[model samples]
Target: MDGSISTSISSSRSSPLRFSHNPPTPRPLLSPTPRLTPASAGRQPSARLRAISPSPSPSPTTPQQRQQEPMEAFGFDALKETFSVDVAAAEARPLNVPLAAPFTIASSRLEAVSNVAVRVELSSGAVGWGEAPVLPSVTAEDQPAALAAVARACELLVAARSAPLGAVLQDVADALPGHAFASARAGVEMAVIDAVANSIRIPLWRLFGGASNTVTTDITIPIVTPNEAAQLAAKYRGQGFQTLKLKVGKNLNSDIEVLKAIRLVHPDCSFILDANEGYTANQAIEVLDRLNEMGVTPVLFEQPVHRDDWEGLREVSIAAMEKYRVAVAADESCRGLLDAQKIIHGNLAHVINIKLAKLGVLGGLEVIDAARKAGIALMIGGMVETRIAMGFAGHLAAGLGCFSFIDLDTPLLLSEDPVYGGYEGILRENPAHLQFPFVNVLLYSYILQL
Candidate 1:
């Protein structure tokens, strides 16, 4: 026997008994069974017996207590304890501002930005601002329609009183669904989320992500005569803009002429051709061929075909990359999550441009996450907007730190900036560097949930 027997006392309510390893086989003589005395029957078990017995059930926990466990585990206990959203009032009105020049693109022309401004006030007296930029050719709603939709949505927001950030944003999205009211939804979402950030004393950049405090942006050169394009290129080049996004596809021949003119004045600068869904597959290919013959290869080709022409977009995208090493981006083609998924899975385009006015803030974030997971490139652009909308885009782009192309320079074209406290004036002082004024002390990913 390698092992020795060990004995332990039982804590059960019984008399003490001897424990033996083995007993003799023959014990024929019978012994009378032992009897319990009156004193022993009345005696209680020892303290050792009580120590090993089962414990009583604990008091039931409250629902609030149960909920707090996960919150504490996720490090959101402090945020929840200190901050909450209680919407006090919401308002929307017309926001019109003049442009420095006629901002002409392939699809439309704008001498001024006719948009709607949104203001969301918290019960804590914190206020946030946003803009619904209206481009008649692109967005579904015009200025009047956007204003009305925003006003209606604002009423819904004010009625919400106090609610979860995600729930409020969802209500706004349901009230204003799809591209028909996307701009309005975005404007309302931006204001509410901004107010939430302010209530928590966090900057929008830090709330999004602390990737970087600044983002470099590319300026747009609208469609114009060759001489005018050259002049604008020179002016922007002097202003230290290294990349120029040229609006093309209105006239293929005129487009080529403008490219040549800009090249003559700023040869070292890189180029991004934004056709704005203005070309057939063949015309887009022909333009690339012309540029190749001129020994010029653009860095990116944006929206070369119509939004619905998936096959055409894929063809241009493939040819641009396979032949001339250019990337074709889907601006109009990618308007929502379905469009983003189609582009990602079918390999329709090399990049997807995100405009908050086209896709609401929530929608934009959903697409950003989806595209990042699929390893697709991102570009952030905007319509002709003031600093309100453009500034919000700048913060998002800077915070995410994932966009390959940044075109939030529309505010630069505005003749007058209506909204203050944004990235507008900073870009002019130093076009290459943009720094937001908000100081970020706490960095967390909880804002992504909102």
Candidate 2:
């Protein structure tokens, strides 16, 4: 969790988690299953990626100057020593997938997932995949914009000749900076990093931190009617989903009713209320008060107010923790490292939701490092995406083993799986648990479950 994060490349394996009888269709892979051998008993962990030393340039005197300064590249000397990556080719394309049902939330409604897919091929013939997920009102870019931005970024990546991996990544970040092009930036980063991991013959999880190979997630129930909520809750309970994240904040009365019906159906399940910036400070507190009256307490309340309402966020956070002993999470309010610094210094919320599409991988890592030092909890969520993006996130979450709450379940809501190559036995039988298979064999594709 500190700045000096080292990598663990363990070969010892455990039996795969038992999944349902029905599994997704398996996609072909370019390489065969990877072989592994147990490390020596006394072997020591090696450092892979680490924070780079500060530059010799003069420090900025003003806050605006500091904000405008580029983030220093994380030293990847370990990667360079092991192997060099030459960006042979890259491409981006429209990735549109049908959702199982309409995904309705506080701010937006969607019948399908419109995203951008990115492919990065190394000169060594190793390939990586990424997805830029677009959620209207949440993400800065729509489908067309994401596609165009990613295409431009891919062209830049291809134009670079034998650049260091870190420099190549920094160039992508420079091209797609801030929320305006964060989704595109994240997609390109994912592809680049995944390709690096493949080139070195290791899984992304191992390349990240190797904390754990699996991550448990909570299923989501979007804003819906009381009856529909109850049915979905019951169905998820049967599916062995222990936690349910309810999307609220559109209508107070309707939200309360839906919660009541869901509670009636699945009384034992824990709840996470994600308002998605739908309520005011007072309304957020009132919802908690009513839930307490019904003898129901959510484990967490997410983004109860708008992103810019810092004061309201702090007020709701304090009230939620003091009165109900429930944690408030800042999702929309935290779009960058500056916002993370504000929340940390001002004590705005108990948890910060880390979405790579919003902050990109490097930006997310910087926030995580800062939050860990400040003793704040973390949550990893994502826009509705296919396995390409969600799978990349799952590797980081599992490898870090630091997130308090995991909400990477959007792939389950998709009607069909597009990019797929993973353990076929791993399926939605236990949809809450995500099992990351060996990525070394998956040079061309990757899959992370719901």
Candidate 3:
């Protein structure tokens, strides 16, 4: 395989791949599916596997030696000037499913689900797809504004007039007046990484230097009445999901009932809890004690209190460890490495959940490294997104082998996605596998301004 990087977007193709909207013309707004042909099928391992196992590790060499080392070149010649067709605007979907309460945290009410889909074309005139989900509950008023800003930015980016990723992020930050838009900024950052990976004819995981293709993931069955939670756990067990995460904090008795039901049905499956920052320090301690009494040991308890309740979390963590032997995992409280460092320094939590959308691509990497160094367990997670977004998460999960669990069920949860031809795309009965050639075409067109 050619390792030389191709910075130019235009290139020739040896095959053609076809794509079509699944339900014909009218409902075509639903994610487009790509059809891969024998000609386009190449038996190459993902790039992530290579990145993790480079032949020579970087040592404490001189700066000259470090600079002299051959860097892995990303081939992008086939991605120039590919996207020409305007995307048809679709009505935004509402993301207001209520979590069976006392589980609601951070905000009193949850509202809309926002998403963005980016299309790429390959040299063979084939099209490839990518997407990112933006959650309004976290982003607040910044969601729509960030999307608009990114759309405008992307238009210029595709035309080769925009700055580099870091520069573009700085520009976006400068243009925005505040920090309330990090969630929205995360979406655009994810989209750009996905686009760059596709343009280079590689899976997102490979782009991140992952060592494996398949990574174990945890299936999250939402917080519900005990019976309902048990039933959901059983269903997921039947579907090959071995690890399960339960949403807690409605009420101590109610939460225990749900755990009891799940333990009875799937006695062997690993378990975790996410309070979504719903617990008080005393309440969290009481619940952990009760769970221990029942012999129901969870791997970790995530975000047991409010995001700003650092003292509360510390109290809860100390109580759980001293009394119940349970460990705490910071989710909302540990937004990125900086937060993770504070939590580590304070001995706040034993583990941390790292969501790519919450931290952006590079920021997520920094958090993973920090968590590893701090001896904290990591969990790779995601919001509700399409296969495109899940693809990126899967790659990251695989790359960061230290993650004790994975929560990448977004694509499986989505009713429909905008683009196809990825891991989930192939698994579906109706295969819409976006081929490398198609991705190359779109990228080339975009780069060339065709």
Best by lDDT: 2
Once superposed on the true structure, which residue ranges of model 2 sit more than 4 Å away at CA? 1-77, 80-83, 423-432, 440-442, 446-450
Clash numbers, per candidate: 0, 0, 34
lDDT tens digits, residues 1-450, model 1?
122211111112222111111211211111121111001000111122111111111112343653453221211223334455688898887887778789888889889778888888889877788788899788999998998999998888877767767777778999999988988888898887777766655666556753444566777899999999999898877666778889998999999999999999989788888999999999999999999999988877899999999999989888877787777789998889999999988988877899999999989988988888887777889988865687688777766677777777776676554442343122222234444444321111111101
Q: Per-prediction TM-score, please?
A: 0.79, 0.82, 0.68
lDDT of 3 by residue, 76-160 (tens): 1222233222222211122222222222333333232355554433233333333445665544333455556556545544444
- Look at candidate 1 and tell me the lDDT of residue 229: 96
Model with the higher TM-score, candidate 1 or 3: 1
**Candidate 2 clash pair list:** none
List the candidates ranked by TM-score, beginning with the highest: 2, 1, 3
Tell me, what's the RMSD of every candidate?
28.4, 11.7, 11.1
Which ten residues in a row are the worst by lDDT in model 1? 34-43
**lDDT per model vs. reference:** 0.70, 0.73, 0.51
Q: What ranking emerges by lDDT with the best candidate at the front?
A: 2, 1, 3
Off by over 4 Å in 1: 1-83, 424-431, 439-450
After best superposition, candidate 1 residue 413: deviation in angstroms?
Answer: 0.3
* Tens digits of lDDT, candidate 2, 97-158: 78888999999999988898888898888888888889868789998999889989888877
Q: Who wins the TM-score comparison?
A: 2
